[model samples]
Target: MRVVLAEDLFLLRDGLTRTLREHGYEVVASVDNGPSLLRALLEEKPDVAVVDVRLPPSYTDEGLQAALEARRRRPGLPILVLSQYVDQLYANELLAGGDGAVGYLLKDRVTNTEQFVDAVGRVAAGGTVMDPQVITKLLSRSQARGMIDSLTPRELDVLEMMAEGRSNVAIAATLHFSESAVAKHTASIFAKLRIAPSTDDNRRVLAVLAYLKR
Candidate 1:
């Protein structure tokens, strides 16, 4: 798979590039600044983009803005955002489109390189992936709205794992529940979230969106 990377730090950028390349992903373009990142996304049209939330030339959300703009121009272009902090505002904006093929992960918490590469692969395959820390913060913010208050604690737990792009079987294994039980929880979550049945949208992604937007 082809990838475009944007990170200002040379060491981390080099390490990430080497890792992805070792894992068989072609680093089509590696950029340090927002403008170059934007140009690479528009011109290279790589299969996936691994971008940082901040970049040079006014390093406050420049990389994020560039990624969002690229997605605006090319909808469904997969992007995996790597950030040192969990900015709820940035996370909300990234998930606001409610589209799959997006991820938000904390750089410091990623101890396993394989895990990071797996997340990139999942996002490229049109899946949503959220760091555990990001999910926790988003859940905390959703509580104030009382929107997800209706969900049982177990349901909330199930939803959190779902937001992390786990399958029903995987969630079952993680939670020590049967697949049928997980499916039941999922169905209940959909109903409580008022996520109506729709063929066009992924209920799992929409469920996460409902909570994050609330």
Candidate 2:
């Protein structure tokens, strides 16, 4: 797939480009600033764009703003945003856009080459891939709310494991409960969170994140 990379760090940009290329992805263009990155997106129309959360000049949310702009310009273009730090506010903004094919992951996660590449592919395929850290922070915030208070201690344990990306079978084994019981608890947690019964796992994760961010 064709990709445009936006990052201000020279070493990181070069390394990431090399890695992506080695993985068979074409690096259409790499830019150091947000404006130029946006220009490249318009010119290249890459299948996906990998961006750093910070860029030149402001070094704040410029990359994120560019991602938003790209979404507006080409609604189907996939975007994967990497950051040195986890920003719940920024995560909320990205999800607020509504459309899928968006990802927010930590830069350090790039070290897991296979996982990182897989995440890129998932985003390109219009799926969401979020860093586990993002999920942890959101879960922590959710736990603070009285929403979780309604849950039984065992149910809370199940929810925590789910936030950790554990499957029902895994959580059941860990908690010594049957898979059916775990599923029941998961359903209950979803109900308490006001998540629709039809919500997919990824969206459930995002809903959990949103609840935590709230």
Candidate 3:
């Protein structure tokens, strides 16, 4: 897979490039700032772009914005965002585009080379992979509303997996539950969360996001 990498830290950038290359991914371009990253995306049209959540020129959400812009320009281009901290706001923004080819994880996750490479491959293949920390934070913040408190532990687990963009089959496999059981839990979650029964994935995602932002 061809990738464009954007991170301000030289050591991390070099290490990432070497690791990804070792894993058989071509690092087409490695940039240090948002503007340069954007330019590289436009010029290279890589299969995927791995970016830091914070980049030069303010070091706030520039990288996130660049990733969003890349998605806007190339609707199917996959993006994986790495961060030193968990930020629900950034996660919301990254998934707002409603494209499935997106991932958000903490930078420390890269130490697990196999998992990190798997995440990259997943995003490139039009899938979503969020850090467990991000999912936990969103779930905790949403639970503060007392609404999420209504859910059983299993129901809460189902809802959290849904928020992570997992399919019923995938959640079932992950939780070691039957597909029918997962479906029931998902239905229960939607009812408790007040998400109308719908086949639309984006609506479900929005419902989960609304609960998180509450």
Candidate 4:
């Protein structure tokens, strides 16, 4: 897969490039700062971007913001954000649009090269891959009243897999249910979450996620 990477650290950036290359990824443009990252994104139009949450100049959320902006410029631009820290707010922001092909993983995830590579591949294939830690934070931080409070535990499980960009068959297998049963649960989830009925799993995932963000 073609990729654009943004990490300010020289060693980590170099290491990431090496790792991705070893895994058969084409690193189209690996940049070290927000501006350069954005420029490379536009110029390279890579299939996916692996960006650190913090980057040059401000040493804050430049990379995350740039990733968001990149998605805006080119809708559904696959992105996999990495960070030394877990910030629920940033995670929510990164996932706001509910566009497919996105991920939020901690830098530690890279230690398992195979898993990390799998995440990259999944996101490139229009799948969502939020870090488990991020998912826990989102669930804990967003369990407010109204819609969220209404979902059953089983519904929540299906919704979580939906957030993971799992297809109905996968979710059914995971939940030990028939695909029709999974569809019923999804319909219930849409009703409870106030998500409008839709055939598009991407939109359904986004709608469920929008509620989770609340």
Candidate 5:
């Protein structure tokens, strides 16, 4: 798959480019700033983009804003954003559209090449992937909102894996439950979250992000 990468750190950017290339992803463009990232996104039209939350110029949410704008211009453009720490606001904004081809991960995750590559592939295939750390923090914050408190413990477990972009079969295997049981729990999650079936949106992504809304 073709990729556009944006990271301010030269060493990390080079390392990630090498990692993705070793895993058979074509690095179409590698940039270090938000404007360059935006240009690359529009010009390269890569299959996926790996962006750092902070980029040059403002060194704030520049990379993220570029990614979001690119998605605005080219809807469903798969993007996996990396941050030094858990930034719930950035994660929420990325998922706010309820599109599935997106991910939010910590930069530290890059050391685990296997998992990082898997996340890239998943996002490229129009799946949502959240860093485990991000998921845990979001879940913790949900207690204040109580949006997910109604869910059973088991259902909450299933929901966590779902947020990590695991398939029903994968979740079932990990949880040692039948696939049918996982399906049932998934359905219940949607119901309890009040996520109505809609042809225009991805309900699974919506369900995974429901707790963040309220």
Candidate 6:
């Protein structure tokens, strides 16, 4: 339950720290940049790391690179990266040498606090978690729809947006509704899809297999 969080934005970092602590996680270290993140990975020896793909200095893939390097030094180091968008290439690299215990989720998913907390625990305990967006992009339309059904037309649309990693704000804009309305749709989608509460993580392990095989 010990965590090291790496995010450059102050508000997000603070929010994540508060969220995790509130859920009974011990955040041993919270740093902003890639180099610092890498160092903390080694120094803190935390149970898990919640990282952002972009970081200070180069502001490109530094945080991801540092995470990779940190894992290189210590294989199977649990890590859960949060991103604004899905990056298949980055995901492939992170999952390269690990047996499991890694996750890549969109920043939007944070709004579902229970799911977010579940993801951290799962990764820290050596489970693989993938964002729905990554799963959708890495999959063909036909291939992706097999496991999901029973959703209403509206719910399906909502689910598709969720798969694309759209935040409520973005979804609202696209669907022309209030953010709260989008949230309601998301709840319905989760319910219909059988994405149970924190117990399962629904953090489906299949997406990792799909990414690996791709």
- Quote each prediction's TM-score: 0.88, 0.78, 0.79, 0.77, 0.85, 0.68
Cα lDDT tens digits for candidate 4, 177-212: 899999999899887776786776666666667776
Clash count for each candidate, listed in order shown: 0, 0, 0, 0, 0, 0
lDDT of 4: 0.82
lDDT of each: 0.84, 0.78, 0.81, 0.82, 0.83, 0.74
Residue pairs clashing in model 1 are none
Regions of candidate 6 where Cα sits further than 4 Å from its true position: 140-212
Q: Model 2 Cα displacement at 50 (Å)?
A: 0.8
**Which is the winner by TM-score between candidate 1 and candidate 4?**
1
TM-score between model 1 and native: 0.88
Ranking by TM-score: 1, 5, 3, 2, 4, 6
Clashes of 5: 0
Ranking by lDDT: 1, 5, 4, 3, 2, 6
List pairs with backbone clashes in candidate 5: none
Q: In model 2, which regions exceed 4 Å deviation?
A: 109-111, 136-144, 149-182, 209-214
In model 4, how large is the Cα lDDT of residue 209? 70
1 or 3: which has the higher TM-score? Answer: 1
Please report the candidate that would top TM-score against the real structure.
1
Candidate 5 lDDT over 57-150, as tens digits, reads 9888899999999999999999998788666776777787776899888876656788899989989988888866787776565643465788
Q: Give the range of the ten consecutive residues with the poorest summed lDDT in model 3.
A: 198-207
The TM-score of predicted model 4 comes to 0.77
How displaced is residue 43 in candidate 4, in Å?
A: 2.6
Can you write out model 2's per-residue Cα lDDT over 1-214, one digit (the tens) per residue? 9999999999989988998999999999999998998899989999999998788779888887887787778887888888887666766777776566778788876577876788788788776777667766555655447876788998878776665444678679999999999889899988887766433655555566556666
Q: Please state every model's RMSD to the true fold in angstroms.
A: 2.5, 3.7, 3.2, 3.2, 3.0, 8.3
